[model samples]
Target chain A: MFSQRLSMALPYAILFAIAAWFFYLAGQFRFTPRGDNIGPDFWPRLALGAMMAICLVQGVRLVLTGRDDEPGLTEGFAAEDGAAPRSSLLLAAGVTLTLAYGALVTVLGFLIATFAFMVLFSYAGHLRAHRTIWLSSALGAGLIVILFQKVVYVSLPRGIPPFSHLTDLFLGLF
Target chain B: MDTLLQLGHGLLVCLQPFNLSMLMIGIALGMLVGVLPGLTLVMGVILVLPFTYQMDVASGIILLTAMYVAGTYGGAFTAILFGIPGEPIDVPLLWDGYKMARAGQPAEALGWTLIAAGGGGIISAIIMVALTEPLAEVALKFSSPEYFAVILFGLASVVALAQSSLANALISLCLGLVIATVGTDTTYGTSRFTFGLPILEDGIEFLVVMVGAYGVGEVLARLERGYAGAPVTQTATARTELPSWRQFAAIKWTFIRSTLLGNIIGIIPGAGATVASFVSYGVEGQVGRRKAQLGTGIPEGIVAPQSAATASVGGAMIPLFAIGIPGSGATAVILGAFMLKGIQPGPQVLLHSGELIYAIFASVFLGIFIMCVLGYFAIRPLVRILDFPEAVVSSFVMVFCFIGAFSIRSSVVDLWLMIAFGLVGYLFDRLRFPIAPLVLGVILGPLAEESFLNTMISFGNDWTVFFTRPISGTLMALTCLALVLPLLGALRHWLWPHDFEETPHSQGSP
Candidate 1:
């Protein structure tokens, strides 16, 4: 019972703490008021204050009612084909792979990073077709590179030496 | 007379080969996005934003606007034939649309959707073209105080109309406002929330926030669900059979009411097609002639929501074009696109870029026509996109999200920021905080601050000036009303629970 209540109350608690931190930081905004001009901290402080008050009220309501007052604005908008089986492990893997891709894109170039991310993420999403995964990922990555780089003229990251060479070679073909 | 002449010229511009092709491609891609359960219309529009970067501004806006227009209608096929709402806007269609299909009238249901979408969209486009100039003229008279009040009203409306707890929405909005406050202050040049990193000074782009939250965030949410909700079954006969004129005449009032309601909702900042669709259906329940038979495979049930959803695209464009305030998520991205091209949309845009404005207006009219034609002939191919594995589609979506973020400033920092926001988006979803308010806050926060600060500085820091000016005062009052009404409704619900028993088939998980 205690754990359940803690779990329910935790989101509000974290929100309150974050809002409080921002409010404090707002106080430290280094702005000297010139004439009638307000400081830069003014808007943020007002927003943060409102946030804190809202968190407090919501936290109290949660404790007293022991339930959310209403459904989320988007609560009932998911698929209606009944509940799907959830996999925490797959979610973790997806998040980890996405974050790793983001971190390594500059290091490994958009081509290599995107290709690897696509294959791994597809697998994480439960696709077991090995040939399809590799082929699609490679083709998808190649098409996107050409489309964005050559067609659209976006200067995509070319990465370090070997990967850079591969990207140039790929670019050279078209 | 002048508007007509300009519109004629605009049509000529739209008919140009390149612009025409963009419109066609945009509509087709939008339909595909709307048909695919994995891709939301806004995400699809965002994914397409980078490609528009190199195009002429007119072609670029046309592409996004065309997608926005078609997206509202494209989801109806899946919703009617398969019981899967391709977009949140189509959720309302599932009740009567799917039921009608189950009752062996899939073609009839799709017919109502096409007529409703086509009719409502064209009417709203007319209204948009007619009203935008006058609205922008009136907006030209607005000062900082009035602008601030309008922005506040928009923000408050988003919170009030939130189907969730008001407090959570408010918190989400406040968090977005805080996020917008990161980096250097525009007025004072003071670094804020930057933690001493050079990358932090330029501030977080709203595109990054949008792509991360709406794009990556959605993928993560679906991944957690293990992509469990594919369409139950496919229908062999998925073609649309448009309603006869006699059938359309019978429910003409439904079309009018829903179209007007959608345009109004679309004109209001913060509300979009989904709200317009849901609210129109609810209104139909209250006032529709066949109200009692709304969800029982009735034409009124399908027409009301589909019309309003499609019409909202035009309605949404009005505020975006006239006042420089985005009326929906998609329009906000359009606003970002306009800013990217160094073109601020407002009264000045009407004055200097009138031809471009008319070109966009023409595209809407032409795009709606093409959308209906395509919807009539291309139902089979569009529905076939569902055959692709969810895992594969999601992977491609992730790559698009990354490319979109990276190309914004070509900075790797933005990619990381996008991932971080993806997490925030997922958390918001899990926690039930609405994402719209957060996004709108980020987009409008700076405007709200600048306007408010300018008002304060202009009036010697007397904040009451906002309440003293007539227009600002009225807007402020409206903002208060928007905020309070939901609470009052909740209070009533709390006091009288049985009276507010959940409306059946009214709310769907989009």
Candidate 2:
């Protein structure tokens, strides 16, 4: 029942902070001088103000409607985590592997990093069957190689400097 | 007919060897993502976006459009077999479809669904082809005021009409508005939510928010029950086949009615497919003989929702091609594709680019035709994906999410942003917050903010400008009416006793 009021209110709390921050930031820009007398600051400040108003209204609505007696704040996140620790662990591993891949891709090159990422991430997630791992990794690498190299023409970095010469030569052979 | 001649040109563009192959690849892949639990059509299209980068705009568009049309229909598969809906819009489809499956008529139920879905798709295409040009011509006349009014209408329907307890929905709507307010206020270079982080300068990525709220949120929802519990049983049998001609003949009117209904509703900005699917089901249920009994695993229950869901595509495209507003989420990604090509999708899209519009018409219709052919034969092979193991696929999704975010700008910030959003989404789900409205906020935020800002600017910050413009004023009244009427009805129900007949009519749970 995430659809209930208080749960919705927490995110709004995040929004209120974001709006105040935006208003603070809006103070920094030089807005355009349109043909009309409307200054550049006009629109951004208005949006910020409206956002603030919407936030205030929503916060009041949540407070007015919150359950009169708070339920014992059950450790809901813990319950969900306890139920699916294995899947959650796999998800975390997947997240970690993806971040590592992102950090490594430019350094190692898209092909090497993506290939390693797909294989590792897939295996870490429980796709350990040999055919499954090889096939999916091949699919991932093929997507990068074909889609980027041929179709989109994105100039993905070759691996680190010394190895790049070989990578360029490899790409050229294709 | 000149229209017939134009179809061949579109076919030439769409049916090019590479494009045709891409279309096939897209449909197949689209179906996989569409049906799989956890992944979404938005993600399906987002993953397809990077592939579109270097192609001619036409081919690029068809590849994505093929996915849009197919993925919209593809969601029905899981809805039918497993009670778990792939997308929230498909939630309504599950009511009758899964019920029909358990009733031992899964074959006929699925068959009727296919016919209705295909029929709705075809009709929507016909409508799009015929009307996009005329609609765009009208859209060309729109000014900032009109755009503002339109966004206002869209925002109202989503935030105000989203759920029961108007107060709750509006609160969610406000949250979206706030997130949208983050990042650099475009008018000024001021950083709002950047939090001293460079990524904050861009504010929150809608993709991050979407994946967080839906993708990660869904994972948390699934995790809640524990994987140790029994998996929902599949109602499919190896012997299931197409419906008999007699059975199909009986629901001819239902098919036609749903197609028209879907197209009409799909045009309303922010009203979206989920609303259309549920509305069609309710109408058919009330009017169709099986209304009371339909969800008991029958053909009508399956056909009505399936067709209605598919029909939303055609319906949604009305605004997309006409005024450049996407009626639903999947099309919003398609709208992103349009923006990428430097093409403004509103009225001029149909006028200056009539052939392209016609070709897209022929292309989408042909794509749907191919979907029917494939859905008929391809499902068996598709179903086999289950045996492949889930971890591998979700992991690939995990990586793809990062790549998709990064490819937008080749920035690492987006990758981390996606992860952060995923965490936010996971927490949101655990906390019981609705995610779509937040997205609707993010997507609509800029539009609404810009429009309201411009309206105020034009009137020199006069609050009355919003209420003073005739078109704007009426809509404002309507917005007030929309917000107030529901609360009034809710209050009346609380204040006075009434028979079911005396109570106000409800649009039903979204």
Badly placed stretches (over 4 Å) of model 1 are: A72-74, A79-82, B231-236, B495-510
DockQ of 1: 0.68
Candidate 1 per-residue C-alpha lDDT over B1-510 given as tens digits, one digit per residue, 9 for 90 to 100 = 999999999999999999999999999999988988889998999989988889999999999999999999989998998888888888889889989999999999999999999999999999999999999999999999999998898899888877568888899899889889999998999999898878889888888999999999989989988887655556556788888899999999999999999999999887899889988988898888988888888899999999999899899999888989888989988998998898989888998899999999999999999999999998888888787788999999999899888888888888889999999998887787878889888988988999999988888889899999999999999999998888887777667766746652335312
DockQ of each: 0.68, 0.22
Report lDDT (CA) for all predictions.
0.88, 0.66
TM-score of candidate 1 versus the correct structure, residues matched by position: 0.96
lDDT of 2 by residue, B1-510 (tens): 777788778888777788788788878887777677556776677667766766766777787778878876776766677665666556656667767766665665566667877878888888877777677776676666777776667666655445334444555566677677667876655556556887677777666666555554454344333322215444344223677788788877777777777788787666666667777777887788666675666666666666777778877887888887778777777776776677867787777887777666777888899988888777766655554455566556655565566666666676666666666666655454445567777776777777666766767767676677776677678777766766676555445534433433332211
- Give Cα distance to truth, residue B507, candidate 2, Å: 9.5
lDDT of 1 at B355: 100
Q: Give, for candidate 2 chain B, the lowest lDDT window spanning 10 residues.
A: B501-510
List of chain B TM-scores, one per candidate: 0.96, 0.86
